[model samples]
Target: MNSEIFSREIIVPQSAIDARGHVNNLVYLEWCLEVAEAHWETKANTDLKKKFAWYVLHHSIDYKASVFEGEQLKVETWIANYKGAKCERLYKIIRLTDQKIIIEAKTDWCLVNANTLRPSKITEEISTLFV
Candidate 1:
């Protein structure tokens, strides 16, 4: 269990842009989920995955700038904090060309039992893996 920030670079595809000529607002939400899943998959082992699952409870995003197709962006995510059954995950999307922040977001996730799909308390062992 390591506290490390996970990052991935992505190019804005044509399909991601809306009629307004910039990346769609919904696309940003999609990116948040994409980065979060990638980060979790990299850290959670097979046994952990089988035992626990995460469900998003809430999300907040701040759009700083608009992005267009072909633009390269870096998406970064990390587990910010956790208590009891819930934890917060943070995200940042930065445009590569000018180093502008495109969007910043926070998502609240609840740990749950894989089979029962019920809320599970995040014990010390599980908390250590993220925080």
Candidate 2:
């Protein structure tokens, strides 16, 4: 994999917030999924339409600011590295209200065979495009 930025606009909702009155940690991950899926389907147009499956192997996040509901934000993600069948991606959540960074995350994902559920390589068509 390689580092290339992809951006998506997001609208935060009440459900995305925690009792502390800010966006929850897990909700940032949900944004990652939303933006990443769009990046894959609309931009890359890869194996997502077929019956391929992607599973998160690991995730790490660092919170820098309090993000509240009803806010417009931009999420940026990019491939950071890869090995075998695993790809590492980095994410940044920036609040448009103030251009302040609210969160950052790193995710490790692996493609799995839809039928066998065993690890599988991302199709060459997909991998080649990330390079």
Candidate 3:
């Protein structure tokens, strides 16, 4: 698979903001999942989806700046590496108004059998899409 970066635009809503008047920590995590799922949906085919699924193994995030309500942000994600059943993904959340990077994150995901929920090897066809 080729190393391709996927991106999406997101708006910070009132519900996403915490008492601190900025986006909550958990909201950033949710955004990470959102972009990841969008990327997978665009790349994975029907047969691939039926054969395997991805489970988040770990997530590491750094909050560089606070995002306020009604702000527009650009979320970019890309696959960093893949081995066996596991792959690493990297993300950047940038504020559109000022072009500031508000968050930097990485998530580790494992391929698993869709039906049994057991870890499964990454097939050559699937790997090609991300390389």
**Winner by TM-score:** 3
lDDT of 2 by residue, 20-72 (tens): 99888888888988887776676555445465666799989999988888999
Worst 10 residues of 2 by lDDT: 42-51
lDDT of 3 by residue, 58-85 (tens): 9999999998999999999998888999
What is candidate 1's CA lDDT for residue 49?
91
Runs in model 3 deviating more than 4 A are none
Q: For candidate 1, what is the lDDT?
A: 0.90
Q: State, as a TM-score between 0 and 1, how close model 3 is to the true structure.
A: 0.95
* Segments of candidate 1 deviating more than 4 angstroms: none
Which whole-number lDDT from 0 to 100 does residue 59 have in model 1?
96
lDDT of 3 at 13: 89
The number of the candidate with the highest lDDT is 3
Clashes of 2: 0
lDDT for each residue of candidate 1 in 9-123, tens digit (9 for 90 to 100): 9999999999999999999999999989987787778998999999999999999999999999999888888888998889999999899999999999999999999999988
Query: Regarding lDDT, does 1 or 3 come out ahead?
Result: 3
